[model samples]
Target: MELTDLRKMRGKQIAVTNGLILTLLTIYFVMISVLDVTFSVLFLILGISILIQAILGFLKSDSTKSFIPIFEQVANYEKQKMGREWNKQRRMGFIWNLILSGLMFMQYYFSRGSTDHVFQIDFTFMFVITLIALGLINISLFLHIRKVDRSTSELDMKGYTWKSSLVAVVVGVVLAVASIAFIMFYILSNL
Candidate 1:
């Protein structure tokens, strides 16, 4: 494929993936609304971010200026480099979605009998598992980007550093511990 064709292909990949995510998020938001559940601010932030991404994805796919910075960088690459990294780029989004689905499945399986709202569905366990899953996903993305950086000369991308990964780990652990402690305090105080 020509360089322009390769860029278009990448743009389409991004658009399709973002579109799927937007659909799923819309479903989730609707479900929570129907159930009268109070959602975290995180969901609002994520929803807005996904909405922006979907719009940017569509623009990129239309061969317009890519609002996403990464795609703009990728556009500078030669067709050969772009082609070589295409498979990895395509797979990364799918793998991330799969991993998240798996985590959600595990959470559902463990909390199956509860008819409670989503928040009370063994959330502490799910929260910790989610933290771990996100960490692993981040590491995987870091490695993928690092590999791509090694081959491409057009982009001077800095992949995730070990220190950043370590910091992420530390923060996740701290959050998990704090959440657990808060849950414990709530239970004990009620008793």
Candidate 2:
């Protein structure tokens, strides 16, 4: 496919994914708000940041200008490298998700003490549903990346940057750390 075609497809995917992410964020915010306002707000900010990044990715120009041809070349090289790495990382993520799902299921099953303290059905249902949604999202992202990798040459001509992936990794790590910290704090406060 042509660069324009690939760009259009990616743009559409980004928009749809961003919309779903926003919806999930809304649900998460509601659930957390019931538990703790502080933790909820922290997650709300993170979700908003993700939404903004997704919007930027979707709106980024695909056209290459003569004035910055060298920059474009560098970006193309980086995208190619990042694409290969991303493919490998995503394969691992898929496997990990499957393992995690199995573990969570087992934990839920084995932790049941009695009917009196039976896991809250609502929480259990939501937990499973959320895990499924996350798994699906990751799978969708993996497929999208695969499609993009197949069309990388076409996209490279348009000056797509692979450095974005590196940046995303750093930002994702920071956000994850912050999320873990917040969860810990929330748990401690409640206890």
lDDT digits (tens) for residues 74-160 of candidate 2: 335434545544344434444444444454445445544423322222454455556655665666566646655565354343323
Best by TM-score: 2
Shift of residue 83 alpha carbon in model 1, Å: 15
| Candidate 1 lDDT tens digits, 52-138 | 554554444424245655555454452345453343343443444444445545555555555555454444544555556556655
TM-score of 1: 0.35
Alpha carbon lDDT of each predicted model: 0.51, 0.50
Stretches of candidate 2 off by over 4 Å are 24-94, 114-178, 186-191
Q: lDDT score of model 1?
A: 0.51
Q: In candidate 2, what residue range of length 10 has the lowest lDDT sum?
A: 112-121
Weakest 10 consecutive residues, lDDT, candidate 1? Answer: 154-163
**Candidate 1: residue 88 lDDT (0-100):** 37
